[model samples]
Target: MSGATTPGLPRLGDLAWAPALDHPELLAPTVAEALRAWAGRDDRVRDLVAVTEIDPDHADTATLNDMHGLPPEASANCVVVAGRRGDVEQVAACVVTAATFADVNTRVRKLLDARKASFLPMDRATAESGMEYGGITPVGLPAGWRVLVDSRFAAPDVLALMGSGVRRSKLLMPGELLCAMPGVEVVEGLGVAR
Candidate 1:
């Protein structure tokens, strides 16, 4: 509403990523509610802003180029992989650029300590994350679950897009800020380019 409109979310070009997460208007309903709940209790986490761009067909490495017009390395995808070890329900929601793919078998497997782990089907991931099927983000996933990020996302210029707890919308914020989100862990030397 303040600047030029993006497809479904705000454009990363429109806002400044500051030390504090200041954009709450960009969130979809569920994420907004969760953020409000979280922010209401603790004042530490910044509310990162996101601009959404939706595609009917889930955009993969090649399709993203034609659909979003954003360079592959410049954009990231949030993939949700869930598993259970003993009584703990392990959920790993990752954000990696189109130029890379999350090492699901290695990075996530050990974290969850599951002999077998698998990516939650798109429908289930979206459903559990409370976001759209194609727009699942690591932001407002179920609490107490570990969220691991690729170390590459810590770069200064990267404007990472994540889910806003809903499919039809997104939260666009600085990659550094995302890495700083509460409970986010940066795996050293992790990530492989696609």
Candidate 2:
């Protein structure tokens, strides 16, 4: 599977991308399932998304982008947040470009209408999401968790490299595809320039 390129692999200059199926070891079960579902439902998504493996140690967006010669803006980071209002608890996944940061404390809090909002503890995040802490993606999060995508991802044909629920590989797909996922809410300024 080393050099084989499938329809799902986009032509990212200098990036050695392969079909997500070729690197199953890098994906959590939920993530792989979601990819398959997307591919089955939409030919465009199947043709636009791809996967590539990397050293697990370099999985963080900044280091991975730098090491892989990918522009920082081409990568998106997924962060899990937890909020509480009275007796209710809410969780959300926020997606933002590497060059920006999520507006968690303010916009997120307002959106959730919670009295308090903060990053979920790593252990709890990994346990509840069934994904590695550093490799969480919005694709397969549990039902009911709102996915907040930055409006910057709405641009046509723009690719965003994101985690595949494991640190050893990354998914590359059009940002528009991400926005189209169920329960995804695209909000302007959700990602503030850093």
Candidate 3:
């Protein structure tokens, strides 16, 4: 399903983009479910959010960007961080442009109110989030998890090219929509240059 040349779908470079709602197979089950549920109430998600298939080998941000001529800074990366204090565990997904890394040590630690915080292990991240290792998006994260968006991504006309919860496809969405997503907290200074 090459949606290449399809008009109205937000895209960078020559990547094909079809409505994510129309290609559930391209999305991880949880992502598809979340989008469907959100779209049921607000059709904007269906209209503005789209997906494009790519070789799983190109799923990594750098590789995909290089393959499609997408600028590195235009892509958003989802990083999962977790911390514990006594018996309580805090988890958050930080969304930042590829030009920077999430400020996990300071900003995110304060946000989570944890004494220390670090990236979650890949195995647990995939299992707990119900998403693949390289394709975890913030959309379908489990309960009690917060989505922390770097303020840089909270603008109109900005696009967040991110995982579709699967390695073989990517989602293209307005950065505004990502900031407006459920459980999102837009914080300034959340991103640190890589």
Candidate 4:
């Protein structure tokens, strides 16, 4: 793919993208499985999703965007949050644009019905999610985990750039696609300007 600048790709940088299913090395084992399953069930997903290699050191949103000279809003970020009420343990994956952060203290806390909420520890997050520490994504989260997506991604034409469940590569798809992924809840106040 010569200078492949697809919708979700950076405008100022050249990234070689290939179908995600064709590059297992770019995904964590669980993420690869989830993608294959999603693609098998929905043909369009198999055709539209793409992945591109990157320096693992640039996996963080700030660094990755800076490396590509991408606008802050060009990508989405995911974080795993956990809180509890009574005997029930609540865990969720919150998604928001890079320009904003998840509203964990107010909006998400209220939604989870917890007195307080905080990001899950890095080690625990990766162990339970079967993904890398810096590359947690909502796409392949556990079935019992709640997935919250910011409502700002309502526009179907907008691209959703996110980790491919690993630090060495990134996933790119239409925002609508990620919002419609299995067990996703699109919330209006999920994101707050940073």
**Among all candidates shown, the one with the greatest TM-score:** 3
After superposition on all CA atoms, what RMSD does each candidate show versus the true structure?
Answer: 5.0, 1.5, 1.2, 2.4
What is the number of backbone collisions in each predicted candidate, taken in the order shown? 11, 0, 0, 0
Q: How well does candidate 2 match the true structure in TM-score terms?
A: 0.94
TM-score order of candidates, top first = 3, 2, 4, 1
RMSD of 3: 1.2
| lDDT (CA) per prediction | 0.62, 0.84, 0.88, 0.82
True-vs-predicted CA distance for residue 128, candidate 4, Å: 0.6
Of the pair 1 and 3, which is ahead by TM-score? 3
Q: Write the per-residue lDDT of candidate 1 for residues 136-192, one digit (tens) a residue.
A: 666777776678888778988676765565444456666776787778888764467
Clashing pairs in 4: none
Cα lDDT for residue 138, model 3?
A: 87
After superposition, the stretches of candidate 4 with alpha carbons farther than 4 Å from their true spots are: 1-13
**1-194: candidate 2 lDDT, tens digit per residue:** 48876754665546688877556777898898877777687776666767887789999877877776888777889999988999999999999999999999999988889999999999998998889978999988988789999999989877888989988888888898889877889989989899
Q: What is the C-alpha lDDT profile of model 4 across 48-143, one tens digit per residue?
A: 788888999989888888788766674879989997887777999999999999999999999899987999999999999999977888778888
Candidate 2 deviant stretches above 4 angstroms: none
How many Å off is the CA of 23 in candidate 4? 0.8
lDDT of 4: 0.82
